[model samples]
Target: MLSSGVLAGSASVQGPQGEVAQFEYSGSMLRINAAQNDGYALLRDGHFYTVGYNNGQPMVFDAGAMLKGFGDMAPQAIHGDLGAEIASLKDTGENEVVAGIQGDVYEVQFIDDSGAQRSESLVLSTDKRAQELRDALFQMMNFAESMTPGQEKAKAQSQDIRARLSSLNAGILRYGSEVTVTEISGEPVAAQRFELPAQPLDLQGLGKLFGQ
Candidate 1:
């Protein structure tokens, strides 16, 4: 295991969620420091818990505090791009609004001071950046879905595009830090499971577009 307080690699965020923020992992701890007033949580032992938040708000957790389920519950299948989106918003407080367009969606939700929750939805097309990424990912999924069995060429192409998108790091958008893509029963599947950092990040100014 790594020593305590080791400076692991960093990741940034982008899109509507704000900045990339910094992430550090050392020993048995993982830390996420957001650029704006953002926050993050972890799923351990079948429970989801908010380990830290920007702006200094006391953390809270329920018996089952996981994010929306992806496997069967996701609006669409979750993949590397989706992982990037989640990491980007990992620190942007609860969303206060949400919207979707033609299968693309945007949501803004947040927990209030009294613990009440509020959210909104809009046609995802309204946000250029959000719509572009959402559409692209959805298009990839749609293509995969529509592919007939034994269409190896098309499947290969789709995975190529997905990997290409996963490589771009404009700001703090982090994805694929530890990703596994495989073929399961003739279907493509991806998983995001990795250790996290244990300290806050300096989101003010980040270096390099994307690291090696």
Candidate 2:
């Protein structure tokens, strides 16, 4: 259920040292500004680009190449699915409020391609406003997964999760201690928001700096 208009939101991801990464997203792009880092990523016409600052100057690079290089460096073959599929959801009979919206809590069980199981609690809202943000997020995720190599299984898994969530007529407010949605709004984002600010620096040249 992709939204016909742009939607924006603020979110945070919990990390070690109690750190949080700030995120802002529209349907077509996602901007991440974290400690010591600032960047935005987008997929256009099946090409992925990461635009960020280096020495306070804007630069763009091939995100897919960077990810593929990382994949090749792995010592062992990755086994489980990168995106896990939800196996079940059970109401916890609890409720929580986030960003001024109330939601129901549910315990969600997930299984990876390797049959590995894990569980987490999620706060989900059926609020109409949240649904718009959820749809935008789904679009962003799809673009990300499509650009990564060898993500076919993971993509399918992600789609299943989206379908399940939609069937519940809910949007996620919080997922365990990892992520939380702080605010959401339907706004028209400028097209320039996704445009690269400067010409892309060749990945080859960038790698030379690190002697890669």
Candidate 3:
């Protein structure tokens, strides 16, 4: 059930029970090509990429949610969260966690799971790439405000500035080797669809329930 002007893509995952897992799109159709056998899916639109992987039973992980989990950081939905100033790096608490200060660079710490210990700092940048990106976006917004002046020259300049800002930025930063980028058109994409059909319940059958 994909919409027009969109594509459908899918990926596979190896399950513990040796069952075949399929991830299908129910909204926009994604075209997948030149795939490897490493259970990875990467979709690209120009320089931007959206990636996801199949877990099992056609359950494809949401890219945004997976990004948050892998980065161990939340998206800047609110105004004052650390995400507003610095991007979150997915650390999984297995090795590190990211901390940020507004208008400054971000740092990572190798924190223990119990939150009782921390290792040395790992600074990502010095000039604050997050804040720089924010500023660039705001600059484009300001340029767009000029369109209300009713001046032809100002309007042209505003359009030029907006395009420059957009082209200058390549979208969100990425981390980790397992992450994949997907190509998606500008539209309301579905989160992901999945179902678990009913099957017989018994010990031996249950052992093979996953197709063992």
Which candidate should be chosen as best, given TM-score against the real structure? 2
Candidate 3's residue-wise lDDT over 69-103, tens digit each?
A: 32211112211111121222332323322222212
**Which ten contiguous residues of candidate 1 have the minimum total lDDT?**
180-189
Model 1: residues >4 Å from true position, as ranges?
A: 1-7, 16-18, 27-29, 43-48, 51-57, 62-65, 68-71, 74-212
Cα deviation of 63 in candidate 3 (Å)?
21
Ranking by TM-score: 2, 1, 3
State TM-scores per candidate. Answer: 0.27, 0.73, 0.19
lDDT of 3: 0.28
lDDT of 1 at 79: 34
Report the candidate with higher lDDT, 1 versus 3. 1
Candidate 2: segments with Cα more than 4 A from true spot? 12-17, 42-46, 68-82, 112-116, 149-151, 187-193, 202-212
Evaluate model 1: give its lDDT. Answer: 0.30
Which is better, 2 or 3, measured by TM-score? 2
- Give lDDT tens digits, candidate 1, residues 1-212: 11123222323333343334443322222333455655554333333344454456544442121222111222222332332211111223222222211222234343333556554332222233332333323342543234223434334444543443334311111222321111001111112322323433322122111110
TM-score of 3: 0.19
Cα deviation in Å at residue 202, candidate 1? 30
Candidate 2 lDDT, tens digit per residue, 1-212?
A: 65445666555545435566655566556655564557766555445677888799988887645544543222113222224777888889999998788999999898865789899898988886677667756765655554345546666776776887788878888888766666554454556666778876556444333324
Give the Cα error of residue 124 in candidate 1, in Å: 29
